[model samples]
Target: MSERMTTATGTRDFLLPDLGEGLSEAEIVEWRVAVGDVVTVDQTVVEVETAKAVVDVPCPYAGRVVALHGAAGEVRPVGQPLITIASLEGGGDDPHATYREEERAGSGNVLIGYGTGHGGSGRRRRRPRLALAAEPTAATADPTPAATATPTTGGATGADGGARTAPLVISPIVRRLARERGLDLAALHGTGPGGVIRRADVEAASAAPAAKLAAVPDSPAAHVGLAPAADGDVVIPLTGIRKAIADKLSRSRREIPEVTIWVDVDATGLLATRAAINAATPDAPVSILALLARICLSGLRRYPQLNAHVDTEGQRIVQSAGVHLGIAAQTDRGLVVPVLRDAQQLTTRELAATLAETTAAARAGTLPPARLTGGTFTLNNYGVFGVDGSTPIINHPEAALLGVGRIVDKPWVVDGQLAVRKVTQLSLTFDHRVCDGGVAGGFLRHVADCVEQPALLVANV
Candidate 1:
């Protein structure tokens, strides 16, 4: 998606390439290069936040920056002009032919499935969509009957597209915005280059409807979108991670017929096991989370059904060959599940190291996009928050999420005698379509068994 184009001039417009497949938009977190500064090919020019992680986008052209399109915190669609670079000296109108070999061959940067060629657009990029969105901000709120052009799917969603051949709509955010405002995309004229429909076009079409909503102030629908905030109400624009979390959770709840099952376990044994292992290797002491993660892998081995996701389109329950365990990390941005790939192949000590590494990276918001996705199963330790239990939502597409609650001293009857035991609650929320209560219960029970009796866990390992 990162394409650049040159005109019959000595300049190249570097468009923001597709950061990841299925991700259509990203917020400009920071810009590394300023106008007039020279930059090398593949040098990071800007950091963008796309749903899950912040990505550093590199400019593929070697030249001086001529123009910077957007600012920090601005959410822009992919393929838009990010930076305009004045090509290296003696460059003709066709920058690709005269530019360095890498410009024609590939970008040589890691941008998901891109960078192997497809660096420059090779043609003039469209007049940017952002400027259009800004120009008609006031003109879009008009209240005339002419205001309803809608951009519907076979086209965008939660991750900024993440469909309309049915039209000139490119950004899913534009499509969703059109749909929300009840505008017909076919009726509205696109002001963008080559007549592509931008978000501004949709907003312009919604002017009449917005004015109508203002007239009928009592309707619940009136308060949506650009509704005026009531006195004392704080408005937080839902974008970035918060919007992503909302869309994902809402979709998970709507599409997944999920169920929850829980059990109380004597976690005293689990703590003891960690203590003993720590005493032996104090320098590399295993964390409680790593122990739980090891046990989850064991449970997944025994009940693979819970480790699979439902391909709703194919109506198939596909089980993964290897475990890409997602650790539900609570970060300043929001809850992001940083994945530990091939967890099944790693030893408990290895898992401990990897888990610590990923969790820290997730918190710091430095993880690459690849490290933040493709999870088959998830382990959520809400226990860290000092909570006892939760019916956690299944991380969408993944069949189940295992929740571990606070381990506290609770009176229990061990060996038929009442005694205080360090106990914890374990819960599993799984996609029922993948497996019924039986598979879910088995996986949850296996985890609890490992927590209560580490001997079973040790034996398996």
Candidate 2:
């Protein structure tokens, strides 16, 4: 970040626009242009990581780069000037113009919410933009080990102790890291330009010898030992997607009064149906998940109460018109739920295709923010991890989550005779605020009935 500079051509500063909901900051992963390079409108200027995924931010104005504000690897806050571009010699160019104005008239692309293309943009209503802070913003540089700065009630005091001023810290992730590690932010000196504290600065301080040895050894032998610390004693700092997941789960647990009800269903018919479908159409086969997804839709239609969210703000249960089915997907980035819009309308084969494509995108870290949101209900098949049953926490703001356990052969009574059957456990965790145990149990029983007899879904299909 830097002061808005103006010259003969009038330099227009481009601030980092808000990427998604609740994303206040992003890390500058890489810059596409250097100082003096010519840039065009809609051309990607930089790539940034904002807890969710890495996104390429496009320039809305074509100009010559006068100066770059933040460097690579530095986290910058939304509405902070990322680059200073000398306005081109044209009548439309205005040094005082903001990114929002240009984006509305030129690109017309809405970054979030309902829009045109599946993975792209469409025309959107103009939203109020955050006004620029009246000051010369500090530039963020690479991080280095330094003395931690002391936390003050107000901003940092000037070197002469004249006036209280704000520190050059921008990212909340940095604050979270410091807070979790109990590191003194005021004690650590910043390596960024204008004393901006980068994430690396907090990380280095967290790993500092003094900080690591803050805990005293329990025994003299432990103190004298040269062996590595125990696994349980190691500190694992939460960051990026992992941190987002932790925050969401914590909020769900704290806010939602949820109750889980599970039933072990004989999935023999469901398994048989999947096998027949796959064998009949080997070229475009259906999966067990697709079959189960269809059955879940049927149950949701019967008990519409389950396909809803507890809107605490509105003090009402918002029942959705269409089901936005969220499939819990596990990837290297962590567990993420990719939602399928109007999932109740999709055929089993279509669901299989969507699931495959969405899963691939999640694994490759290319899933857009639009694809990761608006989940009315979540289906967590944790059975892939080899678990029998789990009390799943409902996805925050969403009322219910269904957990499916591994489908394995088990002893069961079939028509009064004991026999080996394909069995799986189905757990439904719903928000008590939205529905009672009776409603939840009925929904679970419907799903179990479908699993036990695949014909139960024929009417709906």
Candidate 2 TM-score, true structure as reference = 0.69
Please report, as a residue range, the 10-residue window in candidate 2 with the lowest summed lDDT: 128-137
Best by TM-score: 1
What's the residue-level lDDT of 291 in candidate 2?
84
The candidate that achieves the highest lDDT relative to the unseen native structure: 1
* Each candidate structure's count of clashing pairs: 20, 12
TM-score (all chains, Cα) for each model:
0.72, 0.69
Off by over 4 Å in 1: 4-6, 88-99, 105-107, 111-229
lDDT of 1: 0.74
Superposing every Cα of model 1 onto the true structure, what RMSD results?
Answer: 15.5
Encode model 2's per-residue lDDT on 27-102: one tens digit a residue: 7765767787766545456667767776766566656777877875567888799887876554455443444355
- Per-model CA lDDT versus the true structure: 0.74, 0.72
